[model samples]
Target: MLKNSLNWIKKYKIHFIVWALFMLYETVVIGLLFNLYGNPIIYIAHYIVIVSIFYVHANFILAWALRDKTNVIWRLPFIIIIQIILYILLNYSADLILIGLNLIEVKGKHNLDSTFILRNLYRGIYFLGFSTGYYFLSNFLSQRKKTEELEKEKLEKVIQQQKTEQELIIAQNAFLKAQINPHFLFNTLDFIYHKVNMHSEIAGEAVIRLSQMMRYAIDSDEMENTIYLADEIEQVENLIYLYQIRKTNDLNVYFSYTEDVKHLQLIPLVLLTLVENIFKHGDISDDDDIAYINLSILNELLQIQTVNLINHHKVKNTTNSGLNNIHKRLCYAYGNEVSFQYQSIDQHFKANIEIPVKLLKLPI
Candidate 1:
């Protein structure tokens, strides 16, 4: 509170000084106009008393009266009562000072006039009215300045929020691009090592297919946002083939898709993640543990389904990671238009996803 008062004083100090000077000039003008310049004692005494009373009334007494305008019953009457008390006090004190100095005369050429009583009453009320006007003007300007500050602060917050979101998007894209490099290179190297030793020529074939899959992923990140239905299915086939040679143990994996898709475009890397999840978590050792993947274009709708026997005892479940990434990417790209549903029941886990693919341009 003290700091705020100091700040307000600093801000209005020049105005206060200028107004004081104007008051003194008005006093001098009134004296000259009345030809009362010869009575220095009377005029000078009035200058000190009037200036002191108006200053306190404007800054202190009026401030209290206006503090709660809602309580008119008490505050309004309080203002009137205080002004009455101050008027009586000022008159009584001025009389004592003038009489003590032998400046006032009751029965002589310098006797006080009855008209002077009316004039002093008029001056007191007149100064109070002016002081009230200045108080309201100061209040209006303070409110305007506060409102401008709040609006400017709100705008700055919104701009900062937008800037942070943009930066996060750029970082997410970079992180996703980095995700592909290590996994692809390691798989390619493993396949190449087996092929170079001549222990398995089939592994060399897997290496060629892995390179093709990587090319598709990298190209999709660079050149195009969507690819043909056939292109996606071909890459899924290569991913499955790579996994088949990857594990020493036998695996049960199956895929089915219609060949009648005349026009289909899809976001890349979606189907590959599902197949990777199956190999990582599905129970392939059991002859009955089959990982079934289905894809079809029916009436312009593209559907991908994966069903597998979940290895309940496995410590790590790779399906959650793959599905989470797919969900985030799908929502970012397709919003709510794409349908994706997945759940686990007992030992079996099922996922079905559908997207509108017939809207794409016809394949060349």
Candidate 2:
């Protein structure tokens, strides 16, 4: 108990110092104004009670009343009235005790009458106003600090994004220069796939899926700013199928989509990147907790959402660069018209993306 008291005093030493100075100033001002040198015991007791009321009202009662809730209008005033009544009664009780013990002298019987009650009531309201102002000022400064922090973060992100974009441009140029001829690549894959099929059909099917995914990647570069959304969805389906083959169809994952969204055009590779992140960092083998991917158009906006249980073992070694890349591309292509949000909640990794259907002409 003694250790806790020492810690509390240490933490609030500044507050103690400020209050002591304020009390001294008030005492000196009263003495100079009316030459009324008050009883030390009475002054100490009164100041202690007022200080308690200040802290309790600001940090407890007012904080509770202002919390996000319903019917705050009636609740706040009701609580304030109750506190004022309690304060008046407490002051009256304290004075009666002091009078009984002869620790203080009452100059007149009026001190125990309505006049005294009214004075205490006014003091309670006065301190309550001070406490409320303190709470609002503290809250405003805290919010200002948070806003500044967020703006700083945004500035740092913009710098990092510019760097990433430069690196991406260099990487894309290198990839194009090093790429093998499309004709030679497809021919070789087809030939090998036929020979493999003669031996093992499953192995041949895997090669076919691989070839298709490669073709989509290469063709997306040759296409204009946008491709049919159906083409992207098909590649995603093929990728999932390839994973299913690898796991011998043991994986528990579902992909759903509406027919209308497939025909619409949008940036290529965004959905594919999201799905790849899932496969790289998600646990898809749990039968009781299946992963899900959904695609649809809502109110003229294309929506893509994915939810999966995180593979803790895999996530430890993984980075979210893939998700960040998707965000960069979408923001570049669609600007503020696009929305992409992802987070881990309740042990489940979830991502949601929405873009206006009209803004499908740009590329990333």
Candidate 3:
């Protein structure tokens, strides 16, 4: 406790010295006004008792009292009464010290008295007012400083938030560019495969087919809405060839397309998604199940059909999911000009799609 008090005094040493100097100046001014000089020690003792009482009540007692939530307004009476008691005690102690030190002339009979009580009471109000005003002003300035700091922090947070959002947009654009560059990447792969073809024909051929499929994906997603029908068919063919190499060699997968595709323009990836969905959901291992893919032109309308035995339930999940994506994209491109039919019968799933080229509306 003594250490804490010493630390506190050290922290406020400047305040204490300044206040003491102010009291001393007031004392000297009062001596000049009265045109009389008492021993400086007597005045020093006098103001010590008075200033200590009032400043203690103001700085320490009231600081604690006011921050309390309950009975705060009612604390005025209690605080005043405590200060009055302190004032009486401090004055009485000063008088005794004066007489003991022979600092003041003792002209009266030796009778301890409360004769100074009324005068001190009158002085208490002025001292209390000064202390109260100082306390309130200090509190207001402290609160203003805190409010300013809070506003500064909020402003910094806003600026940081904006910077973060800008970084996110840049990252998103970079990600889209990376996603849309597969065509360039696949072309590089094709170049590498051609250079290696002199060493290994089978490896070079497989690499080229994979390159074609990757290029198809990049072109379908990043280029114009409509692509040549031949491009889409070639992607389906590459995908099937890659699958045949990876899957069982004895797998019976049939693919047929009419010659009309050479002159037609079709929505990109329509044929590829259909063929991929078949491989993804079909029972290719069972020799008894049938799987077929066909594309034809009838009455100036391009038609595509796929049938596969459904073993997807045991290995992959493919219940109309691929169909949904195709349906949504085709509907957006061709609207009611597109016809789609899908069904499951006798452990087999079939999908048929037809679109009239004459009734299409192309995006600008």
**Top-scoring candidate (lDDT):** 2
CA lDDT, candidate 3, residue 199: 47
Candidate 3 lDDT by residue in tens digits, 1-364: 9999999999989878978788778777878999767787877786777678667876787887778868778787788788877776776677778888887777775344556777767677667777788778878999999999999989977876465445434433443565646545554565656654554565467667766676677656678878877788788888877777656366668889888665677777778888887787778777777588898878878788999888747535445766898999888888887899888888888889988857433442
lDDT of 1 by residue, 1-364 (tens): 9999999999979967976787668767977899555356676666566666666777787777767778766986677566755764676577667877788755554334456556666777777777667667777888999999999988876775454344334433443565657455545445454543353356456556766776677677775766776887888889887777656437788888777652466667888888877777777666776889998877667788999998877726343877899998877677777788888887887989887774444331
lDDT scores in order: 0.70, 0.83, 0.74
Better of 2 and 3 by lDDT: 2
Model 1 RMSD to the real structure? 20.4
Error of 2 at 269 (Å): 0.7
Which regions of candidate 3 are displaced past 4 Å?
1-184, 191-199, 312-316, 360-364
lDDT, model 3: 0.74
Q: In candidate 1, list every pair of residues with a backbone clash.
A: none
User: How much does candidate 1 score in TM-score?
Assistant: 0.44
Q: 47 in model 1: Cα distance from truth in Å?
A: 99
Q: In model 2, state the lDDT of residue 121.
A: 89
Q: Give a tens-digit lDDT track for model 2, residues 316-343.
A: 8766988889899888878888899999
